[model samples]
Every structure is written in structure tokens, then in C-alpha cells.
Target: MSFCTRFAPSPTGPLHLGHAYSALVAHDMARAQGGSFLLRFEDTDLERSKPEYVRQALDDLAWLGITWDAPPLMQSAHLGIYNQSVEGLTSRGLTYPCRCSRKDIAAALAAPQEGAPHAVYPQTCKTRSMVERGAGDAVRLHMDRALNQASAGLGFIEDGPLHCGVHPIDPAALLDEIGDIVIGRKDIQTAAYFLASAIDDMRQNITHVVRGVDLFEFTQVQILLLDLLGHTPPRYHHHDLIRDDDGKRLAKRDDARAISVYRKDGASPDDIRLMIGL
Candidate 1:
């Protein structure tokens, strides 16, 4: 099969060095393999996503000599598709309504024996019937069933420059660790990151996923979703994240480290590649 990969970045903030490294790595990987490179805007977070940031992200990638096969895929335009997927999953009894708020989950986790990644759902509403799911309910995947589905002989081969190799997932570990992640927020009709991302990758025919190591744990969750949705799982390459001098992973709030700031400082695209050790 032909190799395909994508560089998907949210337009919530200006493209930073971390974004550059990710895009370049994905672009280079596809080019090296004589494959296709796709650019997708992960702007599912409608509240914070801005058109200006989207434009700047495209411009920044262009300046770095990255090119996509077609016009970039924008998530905002595909809300209906995500909604349909959500409906399908819900119909399959693979998702449930979550009434617990973040604060509620946090409070539950604070009690002894709660856990480290604090605030995991205590399944407060897990046993609630579908008829009870109301307008205020958020949709969450049924991790137990999803894991059984994904664990049935699932694996993939990853290809990329920064960190490349085959990575296999244990379905049991996925269920135990990732437990019933939210797919759609009741407050917003748009799909969550995990759902939108998995659907987008399959819909776009992406054969490889190149992203930061910070999201490595979430891969199993995505894998489970793909399996549940009957979509093929793609190869994955989780690269090292760019960090500040203090070793903290870069965030959108770090304006000082934004790529626009680096450009203004006369830093070349090559300079960025070297800075990130690409």
C-alpha cells in the first residue's frame, strides 16, 4: 500500500517551534518515501479557534517548504460528519451519557484510592440507561467493550524520522488506563479531539500519524475508536516534544516561543530545524 501521512495542528495559537518540527518531520517522512503529505487543521475547539491563526499556520508551513496534496482539510467544515460518527457509536451501545462535570470528577478523584492522573470518572453515570441520557449529557466511549474489540489482533508499523519503529498496543492496558474517554461534549456539538482525529485520519486515508510524544498514551484510545468504527488503524510516530529552557513542554500560551516571534528575530526555517535537532 502507498504511504500517506498528515500534519494536523490546531489553529488555537500561532505556529511555534514545536509545530514547525512536527510539520517538517511529517512532510519529510512522506517525501522520503515518495508518498503523500496531507495538511489538516484541527480546529474542533470552536471557542478558541481563530481564522487568523489558521492562516498564519498555513503561511508558516509554506515558509518552511512544506506542501500538501490539496487545500488543507478544515475540521470546522466537517462537523456533520463527526456528529454522524457519534450517532453511529452511540447506536452500537459503545458510548454513554456523562453527566459529571470536570470539577465533579476532580472531587471524586481527590478521595483516597482515586488515582494519579486525577479526576477519572468514578462511573457515577455509567450505569444510567440510554433513555436517561438528556440534553446535558456528554458522550463517553465504553472503554471495556471498545478494548475487547481493539485487542482482537491489532498492530501497525510506524514510519517517520524523529522517532520511527513499530509500536504495538495491549488492548487490556488501553481499557484500564484510558477508561471511557469523552467523544463529544454536551455543551458543543463538535466532536472531541480523540473522536475527530480518528475519524479524520481514516476519512483522509492517512497511513501514518506523526505527532508529539505527549500524545503517545492517547494512541491506544484512538486505536480503540478506529477498531470500533471499523476504520483501519494507521502507523504512528510519536516524536520528542520541544521544551523551554526549563524543560517544560511548549504551550500556546508561550508567546515568547511562537514561530512568528522566531521569524521576526531573523531565525530561518533551517535554524528552527537545527534548534529542534531535526
Candidate 2:
């Protein structure tokens, strides 16, 4: 396939230095390889996503001399597609409905079992069939069955300089680390972040996924998701994160380090590239 990558940011907060670094890296790599660089708005969280933040992100990215190959894609606008993915998975008998809240899950895992590794959801609703799904129920994958169907020895190739290797997807690690993760929400109108992102990458024909190393741990689950969906995952290039003065990775809440603030303070695009060590 032709080279393609994307920088998808949720429009819930300011685009920080980390965002700038990621976007620049994808853009530069795409250009250098004569590939397509896409900008997508991962505004699936309707409660927190805002139109103003979307506008701000576009303005800031353009001001930084970055451009996309096509018009930006809005995750919110494509809910139907994501919804279908949820339904498709469910119909395949690979997923079941869940009604447990975060508190319910916390209570379930509050007490540790003897010599058991830490896990997320305790499978409170794993036994519930789709016919028994209630009004407020979320949808979670039947991870064990999924792994069985996906077969064994699943892995992905990472081309990122920091941690380049053939990383194997351990099913046992997945069952313990990310147990029956929420694929679709209560209303079934949208999907989880990882689920939506995995589907987006598949549909967009992305050949490379360039993001931060902070996401390395989660790559395995996404790879498994893609495999279950019968799609080949793109090569990943997980770069290092840009840290703040205290050496903490920057978050969207770091408004002081936002690209807009830097622009307002007369920091040019070249200055940003230099500051981010591009």
C-alpha cells in the first residue's frame, strides 16, 4: 500500500507541545516519503468535545505550517460507521453487553485474589447475552473467544526509532491488562477511543501510525482488535513524548505550552520546530 499516516486529536482541550511534535513528525514523514498526511478530529466524547476547540486546533495547526492531504474528518460525524462496527462485532458472537459502571468495576477489583495479577473489569457482565442487554448497558468484547478466533502468535512491526522491533501480542497479557474493554457505549451510538481509532486507521488505509511511546503498552490490544476485525494493522512509529520542565509528559491541560499560546507570544513556526527538536 501507499504510505499514509494521521494525527488525530480530540477537540476537548488545547493542542500542547506534545501535539505539535506528533503532528509535525507525521506531516514531515509523509511529505518526505511522498505520502498522505491526514488530520482527523477524534471528537467522539460529545460531553467534552467543543466546536471552539476544533476551530482553535485547525487554526493553530495551519499557523504552524502544517497541512493535510484532504479535508479533515470528524469522528462525531461518522458515528453511524462506528456504530456498525460495534454491531458487527456483536453479531459475530465476539462481543456481549455490559451494564457495569466504573464504580461497579472498582468494587469488583477492590480486593485482590491470592497471587493474581491486577486486572481491569472483573467480567461482571461478561456472561450476559445480547438478548439480555438492558437500556444502560455497554458492549464489551468476549476477549477469550476473540483470542481463540484470532488464533495464536499475533504480532505487529514497529518502525519507530525509540523502540523498533517485532512486538508480539500476548493473549495472556491482554486478558489480564485489558479485560473485555468497552468497545461501544451504553447508547450504542459511539465506540471507545481505541476501537474507533483502530477502525479509522483501517478505513483510511493508513500505512504508518506515528504517535508517542506512552501509547506503546496499548498497541497490543489495538493490534488484536484489528486482527479480530479481519484487517491488517499498519506499521507503527511511536515517538518519544515532549516533556515539561518537571519532566512530565505534557497534557492538553497544559495551556501554557499550547501551540496557540506560543503563537500569541510571537513564536514562529521555525521556533516551534527548533523547540521540539525537529
Error of 2 at 19 (Å): 0.2
The residue-by-residue lDDT of candidate 1 on 1-278, one tens digit each, is 78898999999999888888888988998999999999899888999899999898888888888999978999989999998988888787778888988888887777677666443467777887666777888888887766655546676665545446666777666656667789987754778999999999998998888899888877877877787788779888888889999999999899898888888899998898899898
lDDT of 2 by residue, 94-160 (tens): 8888888888777677756523435678888878899888878888989898888884778999999
Scored by lDDT, model 2 comes in at 0.89
Give stretches of model 2 more than 4 Å off.
112-119
**Candidate 1: deviation at residue 232, Å?**
1.6
Instruction: List pairs with backbone clashes in candidate 2.
Output: none
Q: Count backbone clashes in candidate 2.
A: 0
